[model samples]
Target: MPKSYLITGGAGFIGLTFTKMMLKETDAQITVLDNLTYASRPLEIEALKKNGRFRFIKGDIYEKEDIEKVFYQK
Candidate 1:
């Protein structure tokens, strides 16, 4: 089975770098949760939208409902 990843802060530099590394090295399904905070650059992540294994959510980790929505997503 393919691995599934929930990456917080994924629109930030290091996070985006690690996400790219994962994509290059493994067949993993990735979900990114970011609020487009000051440190985040949505444009960088936007390029990843073309990958079927990747998904992005515009949400804050501090929000309970947002976290629950990602967790329960089918």
Candidate 2:
């Protein structure tokens, strides 16, 4: 079975780097949760969207509903 990943801050530099590395090295599904804050890179995240295994959610970590939705995602 393929693994699944929930990556917070996944649009930031280090997070994006790790995400790309994982995408290249593994077959895991990646769900990226990011608020698109000043430091977040939208273009990079958009680029990742080209892959079928990657998903992105625009949300803040402080939001209970957002976190809950991700945790409860299928």
Taking all chains together, each candidate's TM-score versus the true structure is 0.92, 0.91
Q: Number of the top candidate by lDDT?
A: 2
Give a tens-digit lDDT track for model 1, residues 1-74: 99899999899999999999988899999999999889997888989989999989889899998898688876
Q: Give the clash count for each candidate.
A: 0, 0
Clashing pairs in 1: none
- Lowest-sum lDDT 10-residue window in model 1: 65-74
Cα deviation in Å at residue 61, candidate 2? Answer: 1.7
**For all the candidates, what are their Cα RMSDs to the real structure?**
1.0, 1.3
